[model samples]
Target: MAEFPRNDMATAQDWLRHAVAADAAGDVAVAEQGFLQALLLDAALVDARFGLGVTYFRSARYREAALELRAVMAAGSADAATGILLGKSLYLTGEFPESAKAFELALTSMPLQGDSLRCYARAKTYATMIAGNIADALADYPALAGAEAEPIETVIRDGFGLLSAYGHRDAAAALGQLLITENPDDVVQRHLNDAVAGRAIDHVPASYVEAHFDAFANGFDDKLVNVLGYRVPEQMAELVSRHRTAFDHVLDLGCGTGLAGAHLRPLAGELTGVDLSARMLEQARRRDVYDALTHAEALTHLAAHAATFDLVFAADTLIYFGRLDAVMAAVAEAMTPGGIFAASVETSMHDFEIMPSGRFAHADAYVMRLAEPYFELLERQATDIRLEANTPAKGALFVWRRR
Candidate 1:
């Protein structure tokens, strides 16, 4: 086995610290060199890449900027700032559809103000105008979706994604429209189709959630933990431990890849994991922390296990639900008196809004109102849940006791 110095991580972090300082001090050359050195030491370090990408972006190096920024996003940082920068880079490179998606995600995180708003509008207008000519440009796309060789839905989605990647803005939009026309009742297709059309819908279908998680189940943990800096599982577990030493029965709702299950295992006498995605459940099963792993939607599983749990942990789960009324009532019914319900959620000002990203965010006040009748708020703390486009995404973590 090859051995190296034990301080590689410490040394890499030191390099990262220096790089950030240099970047902030406007020493682009030193900053870039420092970032490169940091990456050489610890290739998995995302901060170095982010800093390098920023430096490259500032230097009119759009291609390098785009490459590094894309890598940062692929690793799990999708904040408005990163998205905006990436969008600009791609746009400058003449990748309009890809740029549109980046700008769209950025706009969802935070609405563009002043000049940024004008720029966004310009981009949107250009993309829209280009889309009007897509049908004539990709005359065979509509026919390709109906081809008998592959699933119609698969063909359409893949074709749309490919066209977008290749900067075929209008063509991709046309394909998306075809998808909607062909699969009018298909929730996943409709939601994605709507996204491409820049429409925000109130409800996200269960099928969309299942398919999204299942598709990314394999890399879920790495993206969430390593890339995005997700700490909800650990944070929630720590909060729960502060109140209770152990739980007789614990239920993990929306336990994708068993992250929360793995954290809560030591505290749970019997851990049960539930999720909408079978692939996610399979990933959870491999962790072996859960005594039972069930493939079912949160509400459906909660309905079958009424008054069954002493503790229910739902980390990064409830964001899928825009309205918590039925699910909250169901959760209350499913919990024993005085049982704990710990969860984290994306924060928003409105009661609940399905953002352009297709996920829901609830205001703290709204969540409190929903839990008032059934769960007593034991603890609620606001924290950075993860990195979105290299920016800290705000979220609120709560531990409530069933009344």
Candidate 2:
């Protein structure tokens, strides 16, 4: 460890030197105390603030590290080291957009280091995933073009190769990376931060769903049925059939490639399918099951035609929604008196959580609570909605009757 020169008079500089020495010697608590003392002596000392921020980062206190580093930058004392640390701290704290900006600034100040490049790429990727901005996400990909040797790059390469063999590599890789990380705890913690901060949207963005399903339309059935063993359509159809054999009018919400539509076609006098993806609607159109297929979001399409349907089916679709209140209200408004709203959702212990897969899971009590005001719970059943990594994905199938 390197030692700093100390003044005999024990000024702020002396305190800073002692603090650095303590930090270098792995005495972070003592270093923190010394750094605070130095700051108290000379509040304008940039190095002391930076050192303190670094100490907090070393201790894995990312929020404090971000605060201290942000203060240092706000005070007009910016440097490559400070910017890199700030970016890393922000990324760890789940402020991805700000982290990207910090990394960009750091790159402008100095050449990209391997760690900084990895953090920058991850920040951009996360921001794109949250915002559903593919163009902006691709803009950052150029930065990673030469980052072939980085661990993240290696993971991404391997992920893409695997997904490519299965088809739809880009979308699959993005979703897969969230599930397959070197440190799942860190990724899960970031998702928790997103959920707690309300940074995770109530519903998965329409743009994201549209883009995903559009890209997936061609291979959707094969991937869902064969690869993932998705059986929600058949399961939900059976659940609805048990209650009623037929309906006057039916709405298939999120009717992705019309899997549910195919199952529910026999039960509907007039079946309408609505989805965010035009490509998905195109695929559904070819099925010739739905009388009408509209390219629109579920809630928006539901709200547009109120009291128009007796049965609304959303098989495996509600998993994209973190909060059920608004959607449930919309469904209630859209259905006729004594109408049935049938949906399936991934289950969780919490009221609702944004999972590492970027999907939302809801507790049974939470779903029921949201439906209480406008509808009555008719049926709820535990079932395997799909298979992930060859394991059953536990979920709940819900049927609600409009009050």
Report lDDT (CA) for all predictions.
0.78, 0.78
Q: Write the per-residue lDDT of candidate 2 for residues 1-403, one digit (tens) a residue.
A: 3354355556788788889999989999989987898898899998999999999999777888999999999999889889899999987766767888888888886877677777777666655645655446555665663553345445444333333222333444454444446455443324433433345466666656766678879999998988778988989889988998789999999898998877898999999998888998888899888999998878888889989999999997888788888899899999999988899999899898765455788999999999999888889999998764334678999998889
State the local distance difference test value for candidate 2. Answer: 0.78
Q: Model 2: what TM-score?
A: 0.55
Tens-digit per-residue lDDT, 66-135, candidate 1? 9998998998866888888888877655565677788888878797555454444434433543567544
Question: Which residue pairs clash within candidate 2?
Answer: none
- Model 1 misplaced stretches (Cα beyond 4 Å): 1-175, 178-186, 194-202
